[model samples]
Target: MGRSLVRHPGVRGCYTAGNKRFLQLNELDELRMDVYENVKLYKEWTKQWHDSKITRKEIIVGDKVLLFNSRFQLFPRNLRSRWSGPFEVVTVFPYGSFELKNNKGECLKVNGHRVKYFYEGQPIQARGELELEDLPSLWDE
Candidate 1:
């Protein structure tokens, strides 16, 4: 009865089958590790590419700049301007911070990223003089 129970299909034994399964498990582990390493490398490359695209703004004291209006984002207006300053830069601090002075003589500290340089346009030249009758009266009878 014991001899009949020990029948084999091929020349390989039970030990060889167990050994092959062990080797396959080790190969699978190595493949998983390789995939993890490739993912990490891809993440680092993407971060470097994204960081390179950002442009750094150079700000200095006494420069005129416009402050970005973040409050307007909540109440959207198509015709309104989002930037609201020709503020003077009173002082510049380290790590992209600036102290700005508005027209009302009020000074506030803000991040440099929120501000951009304001470019002044050319002044308008008067073509001709107007008579007193042409001027609109402020008071009406």
Candidate 2:
């Protein structure tokens, strides 16, 4: 009698390659899991480092500040000044909003991120004192 090519002893099993492929697939899955864990760890470490370097800024009411002006009619030129105001802070909301008063007594509400503290001895000119005729006459068409 010819010996049967049985995989399981005494039970005549077919030679299906499923078991070998299953072991290879399991090994691949474990390798992928390891890579995912490493990426997660790297992201956490970077977040910690970035947070540690940031210093919180606190602004109180009555502090003098300069507002950053980003609005320009055309493409911005490097020579043009962008910082506009030595405005006094009238109110600072718990959320980052500020009420500012200029020398002309005009009040404006702007985001706190656009403002910075005005230090002493800075040369902020007195533009409020100038009359309409002293500057360009817009109505002379």
Candidate 3:
């Protein structure tokens, strides 16, 4: 059910079959859901997460985090470009997600599942130089 292919180009996000919570997420497809789930949880709970285990906001104006460009984008990440750096939390939308910043500190709004904490071992990157550089750019500035 899981296998790391060499990665063929033009393969957008993924193609999942069913909704199996206990499904074997062995291949990258399985992990893809994880990314989706993490961001989703963040999206729904940004308010309650302000000072809780959320640690980071979904996409506030000034929080620092990461963003995964959709496979459909012109410069979308492949096996090589799938992951980007720690972006800033530019603005949090009423819908739940937030605007994000890239390594260059540019604003790019994204959903919760589309982004992560920015750290190793953890799905997204943890806060560090990446987030700090872009934090000041968050909303209400």
Off by over 4 Å in 1: 1-28, 72-74, 123-141
Among the numbered candidates, top TM-score falls to 1
lDDT of 1 by residue, 37-61 (tens): 9999999999999999998887788
Best of the two (1, 3) by TM-score = 1
User: Candidate 3, residues 1-141: lDDT per residue as tens digits?
Assistant: 553334336776543444232245446686898899999998878957664764544334655566675666666445675657777676677766777767776776566777767653646767645666666666666
Clashes of 2: 0
lDDT of 1: 0.86
Model 3 C-alpha lDDT versus the unseen true structure:
0.64
| Backbone clash total, candidate 1 | 0
Best model per lDDT: 1
* Best-first order by TM-score: 1, 2, 3
CA lDDT, every prediction?
0.86, 0.83, 0.64
Segments in model 2 whose C-alpha atoms lie over 4 Å from true places: 1-21, 72-74, 122-141
